[model samples]
Target: MSVNTSNELRLIWVYPDLLSTYGDQGNVIMLARRAQLRGIAAEVVPVRSDEPVPTGGDVYLLGGGEDRPQVLAARRLRADGGLARAAEAGAVLFGVCAGYQLLGEEFAGEEGQPVAGLGLLDIRSERGEQRAVGEVAAQLDPDIAGEMVEGGAPAVRSLTGFENHQGLTRRGPGVRPLARTLTGIGNGDGTDGAYHDHFIGTYLHGPVLARNPALADHLLTLVVGHSLPPVASWADRLHQERLNAVLAGKTRPVCKVQADAEPTGTRRHRHHAPGTCTTSPR
Candidate 1:
């Protein structure tokens, strides 16, 4: 599909019911809103699991889901074969968590069985003993960030979000990581996401685009086929505030509290000392 000649863009949100458990639908909403903010008309399309995947969308999104649902979705998607065709036709794809795994060669199933994936990305996932859960902060790959931003360089140094997954993803030959983890376990390999051509897959789920508007704008840029002029909004302020809080917490020192002495009266005094908590500088 060529760039929408009438300034409209087609955005396909795939399998919402099966893959939107973690508020991943917000990514689609954010994309559409960002497009509208930039004066580009966006037609958001929801592709249910049972429906045929459209092969003519400018952007396609797949979100996280439970193990069984992910397996089913993957199978259904493979059967349709529209997504693979769309990618080949220059469609930009954004996949998160389970969605990310399904875009790869394969992912571990509920019983540790292998679930075949779309093979759009040269990565694979395996179940880990521990599930990574909590906030995540990472520095975007400089080269990738450069391409995503307006002036050929990223305005922010890092992107922050929450991650909760048991899958350990590793990049295969020729697959470049989207970012390097500064905090939290990502992919169990220090990398946070994977990207190649116009496809991006990640484990982040602050509905990612909501937490990282530059990334959203980047997706818009991909569909619109031109660099977009920066536009300010209240959402940008909120995103920066949340990012600041996360990064601050990541770097903040921990304090240890101890009783100074046994209680001799009605109350006891307490002593506190700063604990040695270190994080990699952004």
Candidate 2:
């Protein structure tokens, strides 16, 4: 049945057992939180390899995983056919790293063997000779930037996160890129991700949405068919801090928070402006 109301939304986390790694499941958690903040009921469903994926969901997410597991996930999802059914009925799909690769027609797998994918997005991945691993910073593609930005928050235009993958994806005619790289190997051609209609794919991993709520809200907006409230000051600040850190060449340690550190709302990086950054003592 078509949704006539946006009062409630279902967020599906596909294949958590075989396709979730690098804290990527956090993306689903953040999505749920964003919806609650907007007073929209959100149900997060974590489907494992052993279960049948529920086809009735507003948004579905697939996260990064190891090669062997990725191959398995692709095989299982293809066989289950739930994801394709959901997408055909207008559900939004988001994939990251390994999940990103498997959304396309095919991807290079263990030992560079070929693995067929779901073909939801007209893209393909071939394992690069050298892995791209580090903090990556990118400016959103203008079209995506305009849709994702809230109230003209410039920081939302810049995306920052950690990427550790070997797949060099190439987009086909059906998909437009999600961002242009400013500091790392993205798509191996300066782009970081691909999106077409309601489907999006990317490689960034700080669970992505945690570091960039604008992107999170953008996904939510698509499902809700409207804009979201302004991001919390702290969320915008975190986005700015991460963007600046990598652009200034700060490594992972600079973005680290202590185990007992103050709440994210209370802490601020010394250099909060773009292009310049410093880690505030925790």
Candidate 3:
């Protein structure tokens, strides 16, 4: 399971055709930049239409989108069953926003709810008519708590990001939350995100990897498994120092919205639970 740092690490980004909303693409670029900085080569593959989905990738990234697009991606994945197979083969998976929603067993849509998802994780997405838009503080699970010395998970640190979505998620029975929120139930009560084995699904925003590099490293570690090189030790120390400063709000980078904004044609639709036909096209 060793990843050749000199060789390009294959990272597959699925459902890009529908979930390319926002700055999701930035996430992959951020990962690539970080990997290069560490002397590791990274390759990003975007999976859109029904082509053969890649397997055994070092990492899989999925982002958010509108409800219809979400459904279409779900259906496509379901038919191909690429995600499940990849999970079985131990590929690292990261799902964000609607991408996170579609990773669950089911997603409740506005019109016909309870749509089947990739089912890689035991979670469900419901209508969150109320948006969780603003800065937030979260608590990471204890297992990886000690690793948050620097640019790690936001745990207890204020995370600034915009959350503009209407669907919330609930981890299924036996599932665990990656963190407890300081504010909105971004997902369901008792749930904000999840990571089982190499799979990481979260309502966390795009550029999320930029904000949480430690988590990114964790996923890369999982994907590379025993193949990773010995930690430079100094690298960790330096990384932590820089990360802590950022989390401490001592190093804030200017944030700007991108220029690729375009209307998807779908207007805001009312919320509805599982079942019923209440959908209107965008």
Candidate 4:
């Protein structure tokens, strides 16, 4: 993936029909709006599971999904071959929750069996006995800070979002932890996400990009190959609010062991897992 020399940015949102359990699609919107705000022409391409994924996107995004759907998505993505090719060619890719799990070598299936994944990141996920649900925040790894401009917005030290997952992820030598866990069960080992090369995977999903604009900008910078001019302060205030709340122990709950009944709207995604409430931090 060459540095975006042109003014337009091509972004691909993969498997929306199958992998959009959370409002994680907002991640795509966040990237696009942020780029467009900076005077870059941003084009978002949505690829359904049945459709062919284009391999020419500068960046790609994958969101959360359920057990069966995730299994199907992994299988179909392998057959599609476009995403793997794009990654192999150095496209920047970001995935959250089930999408993150599927980017690894394997993740637990609905029956507790291991299922093959897209193998984009050197990580693995296994189903834990208990579901993890709550607000989460983390201090971004210094490595992430190292990539930022010398005087850019103080280098985004911490990140905040919501998380709901049953899989405990372990990072392999090929990747590094995206951040150190500050609150909530991310990766179940005090690490929040995994990153290697241009691929990033995470469990946090208040549409994680929405809560952490610096990260969104990081991806944009990778594609654009330069430090972008700062846009606004509103996202910084929002980030600080969540970070301060989590640091002060405001662990807002997004799911319980059992929800009495599903809400009428999109919150229905919360009812997918059995025996306990599970969702994409919608």
Best by TM-score: 4
Among these predicted structures, which one has the highest lDDT? Answer: 4
Q: How many backbone clashes does every candidate have?
A: 0, 0, 5, 0
Q: Root-mean-square deviation of each candidate, in angstroms? A: 10.6, 9.5, 10.7, 8.7
Model 1 weakest 10-residue run by lDDT: 262-271
Off by over 4 Å in 4: 3-6, 150-154, 252-282
Each model's TM-score?
A: 0.85, 0.85, 0.73, 0.86
Model 4, residue 45: C-alpha shift (Å):
0.7
Q: What is the lDDT of residue 158 in candidate 1?
A: 71
Q: How much lDDT does each candidate structure score? A: 0.78, 0.78, 0.63, 0.80
Clashing pairs in 2: none
Summarize candidate 3's per-residue lDDT along 178-206 as a digit string, tens digits: 66543334563433577665677778767
Residue lDDT tens for model 2, 83-198: 89898988899999998889998898788898999999988888877777778787777788887664333336778878999878878888887877666766766567889889
lDDT of 2: 0.78
lDDT score for residue 188 of model 3: 39
Give the per-residue Cα lDDT of candidate 4 at 141.
66
Q: Give the clash count for model 3.
A: 5
Model 2: ten consecutive residues of lowest lDDT: 263-272
Candidate 1 residue-wise lDDT at 83: 92
Candidate 1 is scored at a TM of 0.85
